[model samples]
Target: MAGNSWILHRNSSVNFEKIGDSAHTMLIADASEPYEVFGSTTNWRDPELARNTGPQSFGNCFPGETFVLLADGRVIQVPLVENERWKLLRGREELRPDPLATQRPDTPWELGDRPYVPRPRQQSGNRNR
Candidate 1:
């Protein structure tokens, strides 16, 4: 739940996976006492539950933003809204419009809306004789 988090939504349920590891990650139903892990698919379509749980319950570790990898292999950085629910929302819903879209540092420049701007090349100290 710290650095570099990954999430998966399948069969009407959401789960979190650790980046760079093949281990099975459990979905904690309640992070409090009893510490129950979701054993089966959850009823994620319930709007009331989603609104009450908030975004953090949906694997958003960062306070301001969270990076999500879509099923189509596309990665998107979503800006978090305080106390907002994202459990029932699709990945595309969190995406900002073209003009406001932000490209993550790890994302390739070519995939972003902004045109690639390369740094100027430095001239060699030794000039051609």
Candidate 2:
């Protein structure tokens, strides 16, 4: 059980832009301790890859859902669909055109097409002048 768990680390350098009410962003999902490996933006079901390669590897453990903790302190449970498994990757490559001249597979969900505007910063500091 513990061996299959992973820690989802948010990339502090990147600011998450909001769309509507939720922010669907990329997170670095790393396996714990002994299995400490880079698991983000990868296909967990790849035959040539190891089982500990990505968070999706433990999909069977949760039945049909994968839980995610948002930056706003909200936890979400996303369903694990066979065809949408790769959508969990959310790599930057999904935004820009692939330099390798390869075509990316089409997904049912909109990828990199959403208008994610950065949230306006609230004004703070001295105001009682």
Candidate 3:
């Protein structure tokens, strides 16, 4: 073990696996624990979440989406809300839309219909960059 990742998901199940060594790489769900989840094949490891980010990445995982864990302690069901952050972390071409669609950093949007957020601004000083 090289302190890489002792925990990983395979076939929609959670288990501890040492690094560099391949052991099945699959949970092989039991009869009691069905392998159906996340609107697709049973994949326990959250591809949407970046490594080491933890459950905080998912919107519904905490304070919002209800996080559900399997009885056998294998799978985790999180009602995720698609956002730009998630898409970028997906590491795929299917980029996810921005979390804040209304507000764009490049072209700021007004609190109502303008293109700038309503906030108190400070006067500029005599400084050349």
Candidate 4:
């Protein structure tokens, strides 16, 4: 993941500002190497393009779910879901998929077809800070 990036839901018609408490956010640690973002807002025009790339785990991700990509390769999903959490994995350890989640296709976005993109920072004043 790119250092401090934002991602939008692929199928979402509504923007982040309109969404409320229903959003579940999470912080995923990048215990290892950095991940290349596929659909950053500045680079990608269509959010759905990412649905073809990346890990299958992201394929089932919902569109309303906003992902915050960290510089350390960590990822954060907003609005935590019930009984669901992102655990920090150790070296060489693999993440097993949840059978329950696999069965549900309600994820708002798909990140399996394209690479994840880094959301460009908003321009504040004239400094871009």
What would the per-residue lDDT of candidate 2 be over residues 37-101, giving only the tens digit for each residue?
A: 23322222221123233433433233444454434456456555532533533433323222232
* TM-score of every prediction relative to native: 0.26, 0.31, 0.18, 0.21
Report model 2's TM-score to 2 decimal places. Answer: 0.31
Between candidates 2 and 4, name the one with more favorable TM-score. Answer: 2
What are the Cα lDDT values of the candidates?
0.29, 0.31, 0.27, 0.28
Q: Candidate 1: worst 10 consecutive residues by lDDT?
A: 27-36
Give the per-residue Cα lDDT of candidate 3 at 28: 22
Which candidate leads the pack in TM-score? 2
Report the lDDT tens digits of candidate 3 across residue range 11-129: 22222332122222212211111222223221233334432233212222132222322223444332335334233332322222233421213443333665433333233234553
**On residues 1-129, what C-alpha lDDT tens digit does candidate 4 reach at each position?**
221111222232433333222223222212111123344331211211232134322212233343544323455553323113322211111122223322323333447896444343222233334
Clashes of 3: 4
Clashes of 2: 0
Order of candidate numbers by TM-score, starting with the best: 2, 1, 4, 3
Best by lDDT: 2
Q: Model 4 residue 104 lDDT?
A: 21
Candidate 3 C-alpha error for residue 2, in Å: 22
Q: How would you encode candidate 1's per-residue C-alpha lDDT over 4-32 as one tens digit per residue?
A: 11232232222232222222121222211
